[model samples]
Target: MAHSPLDPASSLPTGPAPRVSVIVCYLNGANFIEEAIGSVLAQDCSDWELVLVNDGSSDESPAIAARHAANDPRIRTLSHPDGRNHGVAAARKLGVDAARGRHIVFLDHDDVLRPWALSRMTGILEREADVAMVFARTLYWAWDMTIGKEEMESSFAPFPPGRLAGQVMLRDLIRWDTRHPPPCSIALRRDVLLATRGDGALWHGMYEETALLMKILARHDVWLLDEVVSSYRMHPDSMCIKAEAAGTLSNETVSRDRVRYIGWAARHVAMDWRSRLLALTVWLKGEAKLRLAPRR
Candidate 1:
């Protein structure tokens, strides 16, 4: 289906521009898509738009997304020309291109945003002129009642809650010295996101967010929040879990992806001598980790 941008004159409710555009790209996510959409609907901040990109779902998720869009004008659904599965990164790019908000928030189909997520993050962005983005802690949720409490907990980054230089954060992320911000927990300026696009058309496989974040950090500073703003559901069907089950989560695969990420960084992110040195260090560390890790 042909996807069109949200027309302010017709598609949106009469008001100021949406403060945030929440993008949820799903592929056969019928089971959890509703809860995800509901979380966005439940957001205390009403000044937001929801774009549900149907990434070639074979199940009833398209219908679910359509139903939600029918009930709420703030929600719109989009897909590729032939409704093909173009991977998460491409679907996200499509959503970003069509988003009509000042800021962007990426919510996975299986994840839920807390009610205060948009308000809290957007508030920081508005007040901090130098900050290009803001991210907070995320709850790793074991929503299945059968699961134990140990599996359900909060994840906090090592960074303090305040504005931080992008280069420093980027280096830490590459070196695996800190917990990177999950996509669900981040809200970034739309303009900054567009500007941060690297040489790649779409980051293939995993580490897509890493590529995007590295680009952003190379150019701007970001704000860190101490509060938990989203819940990331831990389930068997998650990408990492599935990869592990399929034997594709091997160190070899991860090392290859990491190498690709480092190469992308070299071209698009680490321009200065110091940054390049950090990239080299990260590469050496990755090689050592790969060599030390046991084969699947």
Candidate 2:
């Protein structure tokens, strides 16, 4: 049989593989798969892989991925065991398991990367020598797929390597105002993920990014790339919107998730005495407030 245009053998050139692997944890992501895949494929840096983890999507996500993967060896697709929605944490680890690159970037099913994302992020990592994780700013994308403005994310704000990172992190722990773009805009040496054990329990009821951020903070020097490297699409079907719409467990989950992150900062992040004391007070007050709130 002659080769079809859909085959990876026909469309992708097999040569030097990428040093970075982007993990995409997807659920019912059929509509956005192409844009998500295309963003990484268009990266300025050529040495990267796109690991697409299909966590038992109900729609045509798998079929969509199949068509795309057929023509690109760089796109690796893995299915959830027994076709279950194994959550983002598990899906991400599975993506990591399949990754061959030394560096990793993660994207949501609906997010897209700017072409320079990897090239610029890793530029810092390679030069900084001691840094283990890095993240950049994100360009917002509205539901209609139009470009939005650039936004800066929060990290353990400007500090040279040492205990100061933990201090600033602890001070802002309860505020929940510090912005790190979700996993899509973050990149790390593969070692950070390996060290964290990739557990979903880390996130508790909220999503995975916060847990991973706190966990990563424990061991790595995270840097801000300051470039808008990806687009986070805002849509009606977004989990937070639906939760707010239903007015039920979603509220409780978000609350619990917030505490989990604050708790992580309190417990693991090393800080100055004043910062620690403040964190302790904040933790107690927040815990009390949440414990008293009636669950729906």
Candidate 3:
């Protein structure tokens, strides 16, 4: 049988694979690319490979990534041909296709991983066979709020630390008990990710990570580490911020798309009709709140 591009068992180069593949996807993020790549290099666990995907960046991002790649044998770079910019999801797929690790984690060019992140999460995955995904808390460091101010005053974890630790099932995640951690904070078994691959175009403009998370959650329970493993930078040019500024993403659009995502998840994850109905009800109530909300 011919192997699919998404298949982990496909004919990849034969060699010693890394324990973890840290994929940092970026475009025109020259200012923060160094810091993002630096965080991975500074990891406590050194048995990892850094895959830097340059999605047709016009800035010094490609140059910086190349410099780092030249200096470190563990770093490899990939880019979209012809210098045409592909969106985030396509960039991610490129990295995933070239990954050579047992476990995989996605990092953005603007985020920074804590020094202990790799060792801690990989440790948990190694120790627990049942846990398909392990995610940790993130500290949202707002750039506008942090500039010229004391570092201590700038960042915060929106969710209380230690509140949602331990193994959580798919149903629990769907309940919306807490915010879903960003892609940077979560690590997954590579095989599991490949098997649940969806049409990358579906997530081109929005909800990329959410779609992937829902699929992973469907088949296996995830572990939540109480510690903050990464820092998510929130700046004016960030994707969500840009969408909001352009009026392309509104409360109504978000709610409606979420309901659509829930239905998609229910169908693909093989959920029973009862669970699907329950998910529908949850979103309906959420939609009601948006309707009742006062206009700004």
Candidate 4:
């Protein structure tokens, strides 16, 4: 279905452009879209616009998003013009293209951003001119629980409020770190995102954030915010779970993704032979573990 011809934000008097553009992507996510939009609407920071990309879902997601846009000027619903299921990367790229904010943050339809998430993350980017991305901690919310049952706390990154890390360290961490920020818990500069948005085909249409993060790290410093600013719901219906169910989460797929990441890193950033070798070894070990681990 086509979006409304009339602009949703036109009714409200125009003001200065928003400081943050929140891009949420979803396909057949009617079950959790409302809660996700509610989290964004409930943000303590008011200077933001919600760009909801429906991704041509064959469910109620587009309708729900349209209804939300009708009520709130800050929310805009969009979809692929062809009305087909392009992957998350393409959907996100479309949202980014339509965004009009200085900073950008991505929210998964099944996830949530805490009240202070926008204010806290954007403030860091503003204060630190050198920092290209600001990522925070996330709470792992079990499907049955109202609140997060466990904190996906970081033990490897530099501590407390925040810490800045350079390209070399960030690259190493991605290849080897035990705990790192997921896309849901991070905000990035719009220019950088646009410049590095490679085709969405990496990893055979998986791990889009991994490619984006590597691109960001190649040229910019990353800030690790120790505060928890989002909740990542762990449910069987998640994309990862579905992939696992389809037997696509095997070592072969993981290795292919790792190879793609290494090649991308080599092109963008010059890492020494040792670092590259270390990264490959780490991937091998992880794949080995996955092979040995019992199925759920």
How many backbone clashes can be found in candidate 2? 5
Candidate 1, pairs of clashing residues:
none
C-alpha lDDT values of all predictions: 0.79, 0.67, 0.72, 0.73
Best by lDDT: 1
Q: Write the per-residue lDDT of candidate 1 for residues 1-296, one digit (tens) a residue.
A: 44343222224445676989999999999999999999999998799999989888899998898888878988888888777899888898889988989999999999999999999999999899889999788887877644332344444456678998888887777766225667899999999888776444535576778777877887789888989899988777787556556654444344545666776677666455788788877777667777776766
lDDT of 2 by residue, 1-296 (tens): 56433222333435665678888878988888789988888988877877777887888887777777777777767776566888777787777877777788888888898899998887777777677777676765566543232343334345432322533443553455335576678778887678676433355445346656656665555665656788887766665455455553233334644554566656654445675577577667777877787765
* Candidate 3 per-residue C-alpha lDDT over 1-296 given as tens digits, one digit per residue, 9 for 90 to 100: 97432232333445699999999989898999899999999999888998888887888888898788768878888876555688888888889989999899999999999999988888888887877888777877766663322222211144343223222344554565335778888898888888778423233345567767766665576776777888888777787666556654454344444555655665555445555667677767756865775533
Q: Who is ahead in lDDT, 1 or 2?
A: 1
As a whole number from 0 to 100, the lDDT of residue 174 in candidate 3 is 57
Could you give the candidate ranking by lDDT, starting with the highest? Answer: 1, 4, 3, 2
TM-scores, in order shown? 0.86, 0.79, 0.80, 0.81
* Candidate 2 ranges with C-alpha deviation above 4 Å: 1-17, 144-174, 198-201, 246-256, 268-276, 291-296
Clashing pairs in 2: 18-47, 18-48, 19-47, 153-179, 154-179
Q: In the order shown, what is each candidate's alpha-carbon RMSD?
A: 3.7, 5.3, 6.1, 4.5
The best candidate by TM-score is: 1
C-alpha lDDT (0 to 100) for residue 221 of candidate 4: 77
**Winner by TM-score between candidate 2 and candidate 1:** 1
lDDT computed for candidate 4: 0.73
